[model samples]
Target: MATSPLQTPISTRRAAILQRTGEALEARLEAERERIGLWLPVALGAGIAAWFALPAHAHWIGLLLALAAGLLFGLLVGWHSRLGRSLFVGSGAAAAGILLIWTRALWVAAPVLAAPVTTSFSAIVERVEPLPARGQVRILALPQRRSDLPPRVRLTLRAGQAAGLAEGETIGVRTRLMPPPTASLPGGYDFAQRAWFDGIGAVGTILGEVSRVPGKEAAAPPLRTRLSAHIQGEVEGSAGGIAAALVTGDRGAISEADEEAMRRSGLAHLLSISGLHVTAVVGFAMLLAMRLLALNRRLALAGLVLPLAAAAGALAGGGYTWLAGAEVPTLRSFIAALLVLVAFLMGREALTLRLVAAGALIVLIWRPEALVGPSFQLSFAAVTAIIALHEGPPMQRFLARRDEPWLFRLGRGIAGLLITGLVVEVALAPIALFHFHKAGLYGALANVVAIPLTTFVIMPAEALALLFDSVGLGAPFWWVAEQALRALIALAHGVANAPGAVATMPNFPPWGFAFAVFGGLWILLWRTRWRYAGAVPLAIGMAALLAAPRPDLLVTGDGRHIAAALPDGGYALLRDRAGDYVRDTVAEAAGVDAPLLALAELGHVECNRDFCRWAQGEGSARRIILASHGRDRIEGADMAAACAAADVVISDRWLPHECVGRWITIDRDSLAETGGLAIYLGEAPEAVAALRAGDAHPWRLPQQLSGNDEAVPKAALAR
Candidate 1:
């Protein structure tokens, strides 16, 4: 087994090269050890947030597991000098911190859980805003007599119901209070949890007319509410709504069509008070401060310019956070901006994963429930992707070259924007599909044009207008802001109307989302060639998303409506002109755009009053009937024949025992427990139903889950 001299030398060199590569990888990891370790808390925080989604009885198990891990990590940290276990200690601290915060969230939600539901209440109108409908309005009121409930409650009023009502005015309203909604489907959106975090105990519609009541308190509205009303009055029409949203986060004023256009064109982020708006405010304040400092010789010479500028930026960001209601996304952005300003003062780069982690940690600590929101997902995903691209190997190699001149900085800036837009679009696409079941076709191009306009033109004008209003000289500034907003809205409409502006995709499964999230985090956090391995999960996630299947039948959360997909590819509504939100949700889940209005354009869906039935052939799985009437109306000979003919029957009425035959029937009892059901057409009647989990979570009262025997499922008995 003797080898030739040439072969031996080549083998030796190959071995040396492999050794060098391994050393280099280790060195890179060592360099980033602290930064990578900073995210230990972030991961723990996410785990804690997810813990709330579990069944109520399962919480003790999670708490025990958390404690075990914390104890284990602490032990490891005790042997730190020998094992380099500082990162372990940090992770343990993070896990403990999150556990405490989760407990706090439950405690905060307790009073609301204990609140009683009543039909009449007297309250002070804390705030009021126009709803999307012509004459509807949303009121945020403070309950005066209900000591057990949370202080704030939200109510919807019909047209002319609150004609003369204003914020801070006491009013007597007769309304039936209802709990915040549970998930529409199993693992779906949980409005109950969101309401818990928002401090809203109940939601209701005002009955009849609202009557004025005498109150001793002042009738002046909060500063932010008054500002929003003033902006709406001055700006006029949809543009005014846009202005109000930019300044006060009152997006309810925007019409449905305009809002849809913005969403389709990927410009909807402009309406939210997020990273872009916060950064603009901070940048403007920083610039103004730097300029002001330059005029002072003593301060400028004392190296105080950067520090002063950072202080000003912090003040502006804090002010904007308050004005925007300190919502989850806005608060996340403010924390990040504050971190960046601090980095700038410390002579370090602001764009780093550590800063993002710090911001996320703070936000999760305050409101762990935010982890489930689209805003939190979208904001964090976009920022992480952009930062990864900036710090990637390719970008580093490009920056290593020193031949470029300063005059080309503008071109480089433009190129950077294009790259960032592309990166962010790609990163956020999977998340959008998982959440909304659609992706904007022109999002990248739209962002390229809209981002700069929003950042430099619209937001700045709005900020200036807000500033001017404080001095009673806001009219001219508002006019300028309106012009900018008009241009932006027009651009959104134009882009949205373009051919193939949005692509409807089937909703990705939870497993697919997990893969994508982990893959992206791996690529961003790891500093070695091993990071490339993340692409494996990324590709798998994309494939899963593309291959996901759509359900054949969809039932609304209230069980008041249902839709069945026809063999010919159109969706038929169970009721005419009702359940608009439900219809749209089902359509999105089915990977169809505009289910209600565009259903005709895509395919035909016949509607009627009593029932909507669809059948492909004489098979049990192919025939489906949804009845809206009661048993008395549907149990007649004609109705019995029709019901007996179908293999699947869904009704809001009670079905007789004799009626249960070789078929699957969902009636009042079933619908009462299961919020909704998604049925997939198959030979065996395969389907999934979403039921209200009878559990002891903070949002679910023990009494509500205890006495609901009808919520249990029962298999059919053979005759």
Candidate 2:
């Protein structure tokens, strides 16, 4: 064995290399096993939850049948290794879950089929479109129809009359009832799905005669609403309207400039009834209750007093946690509070993971649709990450060091804010890209300042204002509250407008969302020294998002102008004439910023007219025209003439006449353009050329408009 020294060295080197490789392989296998172990139970629980939460119309029998089949399949798999047996169980549960899901889908479709004939209805206006434009109204109707109404609700109207309608106003309207619109892209906002879950069968505007129902008042505002309103009024009376919104999240009074400041500063969420606001209110209430209880046995009545007081605080603070429209973060706070109350009464430990999981399970069972909502995803991600980071040995030890100074505390808070923001953003980035196609670059910076202010200042002040109002000394407190609100609004607007505040993203598939979420969960749940392994899916998700294809055009509707299209797959902004703030809206909804930049960089020539035209040469093929006219005509030429031989036509209004060739409408277009195969966006000339260049059958044009008697244009040919 020791024949030569050189042989011995070579043998040792080979042994070392083999040992290292084997260790790596073993480690990978262990990770996979751990992952499966953790996920299997969660998946089974989810499956069971899904099964039990099926709606009334779901096919219970079908699901049971599927369960039976899955059980048999599981038994077959169980004949193999123990791991296979566990997997088989999980698979059986998953099969039942899938069956239930399918049943639910069928159930949802039943109403559409059974009740094909839709009825019209009239209702009072509860909330107007937050942003301005003509006739975009969010009305609550009584499920009745009226004669002499527009077939389709008219969203756009002339300025003055349309803007006059206010929240809490009753109005008569006739509308065609239908489901909410489905998402056009994967991972997109399923407005229809949300509406289905919310029980909104159809949504439309007012028509026919305008009549007011006297004495038929709106549903008495919730207790919180009344208190909030009272506080807002008091604040406006003393400080101003702008001041009121900053304190109370009632932005109806704030000035445009202040609003803009808050947005630019990334503090806009402070003004809204979100997690920050709710958590602050809850924490304050808890502290007050604890202090009051410590006074004496006589004052420390535990039965219902404390709970009642907390409930009152919740209600006064706009039912911060109980708001139907609240996002997942706020809901989590509410559930956590409920759990704490329960634990306090039952003499159990406080704030345990099991309690959190129970609360989450309850929510998921109640509203399965929320599983896909941004608020739910982001909130859970942040909470999970925080828990993981806190539990880590190094962080735990660091925090245990009591010698840390006030500066350290402050620094820690800031760091926590940034970390939380980054975690939530990473979890949500995929969906954001898939949905809005943009990212808030300064979201973390904005949160660092705004979050603390919201928790420590604005919300607390608002709560105080409400208390003062209840105590009959409302005026002084209201004034202070309003002033605080104004300040908050100013902060948000400032943050929103800051340079490099937002970055536009490319659209991605829904699967990207699944990957991102899985990666996040893996990182948060894994207990290992090499935590970076969790970044694999996160990285892939981001890469997938970056590589997503850009839309040929972006169309935006402020619920008024049918839609605004932007060339180069960027954003388009629809003007809000009434000056209502547009939240989380993107410019890309109107037009593509990247292509617009590219055009500028390439020194494309510009043409002056109602239609702003950019061109390089006659045959260069990249032609973009921004049609700005309201009437849909320019210099004796209709949209058809203006768009003739054009590759892409971006317009503010819809045009029916430009369906003859490969024209991409910017905003509005007739059904013909959307349904007809003759026109397409020229945004990617290469793709268009490829389609035309091939010796293949062209896209078939419709013989007639679907459901319409109109014939298809003979000259129209799809390429």
Candidate 3:
């Protein structure tokens, strides 16, 4: 195919153009080559993502392909096939990621509670989580001598019932334990799957009483829990709960209002044990160790100060991680922090995309499930954005201006914080929306103050208080910590209460989120000018809401709650007395935040004790929805009439054969398979269910739900 220039004499202009284009591409690729290794984790994550997106039937095939890729990659390497090696290696890494999660899932498999049981059991209390705000206590326990029960179960009881119980106490519990809950709505979080992975087969509430076991002895309370209790005691009110969260990673005591305030203000990350808290602990420990060691002239002369300080930092970080319950996010930050300290000891560039990739790769191997979590995405995105920011010329200049006046440097530092916060907010917006359906628009503004206050005042003071508490001299430090926490909480409340502080949208399409994630990575991972092109996909993702409007009808997994949007920009509920929690969740999922008015209250829909009829659209284009309200099912005669008239009929109970809807009929049996239904009405309507096609995972639904779904329209299984 290649003719020499002399054999196929091209025009001079065309030749010049081709040569210039080739040169430009070569230059771009050369830049990419410098950071090509960073793509390794991206490839690995891609495989993991593919596994989750895949149906249960395809899982084994995914594992096999990964194995094949690995074998092929080894062959290519041994054959010295350099060109083929790159292709196989990338695919092999991805495939390996698939195998990683598959193996992990199997490795952690445990029995799930099949049905609800209300009985008394002698259980060793593994952990007692206090919820002062809600006046509840969550008990993680191990049932003894009960072969019928799972090894571990979680119980929620009134705080007063378990007031004296601690981590090691053996307690008698009379509780109702049921299988962990599935997604509350279509695409909602799967508590059952997470519970399965956590070895918790059941979650329930104490129905009768909690008392100490006579035979077993209770050990001394754990230092972590003790610290949490002490911190909360030292600080008054809800601020104490936040302070405890900062120091111990236990957020059980935070009030609903405070949590909401913090979330809306974008300061919720402070409540979770992650980067900022870990960095503070490590950096402070290192600085303190270095300063103390420098006083030893011999240690300073031998140049062991930095190494020893780094060791101290690593030890402290590990300790803190353990104290924080070693949750995924805390563990992830600990690993990354450990790596950074190692890089420091090596006298290498400490922060780089390469470092970020390595950290991500390690976490993926250890806990591949974290790849799909918001914590992993948000934490990594923030760190990547900050590191990439420093690569920009403006930051390079700012960082290099060490000799500038102190006041000017202070001003510059504040400006840098503002810019960094803004940049991070933009990067995290899509992720927040994807997970929580809301993004704190003013999170950047809140973080500017909250971050500094937490880092410099609250956390440090809390640390000192803990240190001095060993000798009863911690009161002053405790006071200092409390005041700082009060300020932080106040700041959160103030920022969150502001108008338009957070923006919520409906569920964004998975395809759009994928594109946005890819585009964001492209911009942050590469240094070439091609990075600008990432904006195109990012724009497409942000425009997803406009492409699809809000759902016309929504129903809960239990079919107890149903809501529809009214023409007046409000909500009409089939149930006049739906619980606020159920109503709000459905409303938020439908991309609206409005009060729900009963169908009886809304003139557009006709409602009575037995049934409700809603007319959508006008003239021949209209669709009639006849919903069973007070009764489980319509009478045979009424059912036939409804079948002939209504476009769709919804019932929480099984309907007769004669009740076939003109377009679609959703009854108890259908709801049993679908879990939940979100139907968007239009010329060609679509329905999204809580359970998608081939969702036969044990944690998703009961095996008994294998009733033929072929009769249900395909749209009901839409993602």
RMSD of each: 8.4, 10.7, 6.9
Per-residue lDDT tens digits of candidate 1, residues 1-719?
89998999999999999778756655665666666565665566645654554555566466657756766755654543312244355446545655665686667653453333545556878777766435688888886655544577789997588765678787777665666676675445668777776777777787777767534444556767677778878788778888888877878668878888999999888889899888988999999999999899999999998899999999988998999888888989999998898788788999898888888878877777677678988999898888878888787665454567886766776677787788888888888887888888788888888888878877787778777888988778778888888888898999999989888875577777878877877777777677888899988888888886667777766666666665566566655566556666777767777554332222333335565555533455465553553324544545566667766777777665545423677777877667677777766665565654565566666223111112111111000
How close to the true structure is residue 584 of candidate 3, measured as C-alpha lDDT? 62
Pairs in steric clash, model 3 = none
Kindly report which residue stretches of model 3 are placed more than 4 angstroms away from their true locations once superposed: 1-28, 59-84, 215-217, 402-406, 617-621, 631-634, 701-719
After TM-score superposition, the amount by which residue 632's alpha carbon in candidate 2 deviates from its true location, in angstroms, is 8.9
TM-score, one value per model = 0.84, 0.66, 0.90
Candidate 3 lowest-lDDT run of ten: 704-713
TM-score of 1: 0.84
> Which scores higher on TM-score, 1 or 2?
1
Q: Where does candidate 2 stray beyond 4 Å? A: 1-137, 145-171, 174-190, 207-209, 213-225, 236-274, 298-330, 341-356, 404-428, 529-531, 552-586, 589-719
Between candidates 1 and 3, the lDDT winner:
3
- Model 2, residue 307: distance off in Å is 9.6
lDDT of 1 at 603: 31
Per-model CA lDDT versus the true structure: 0.71, 0.48, 0.80
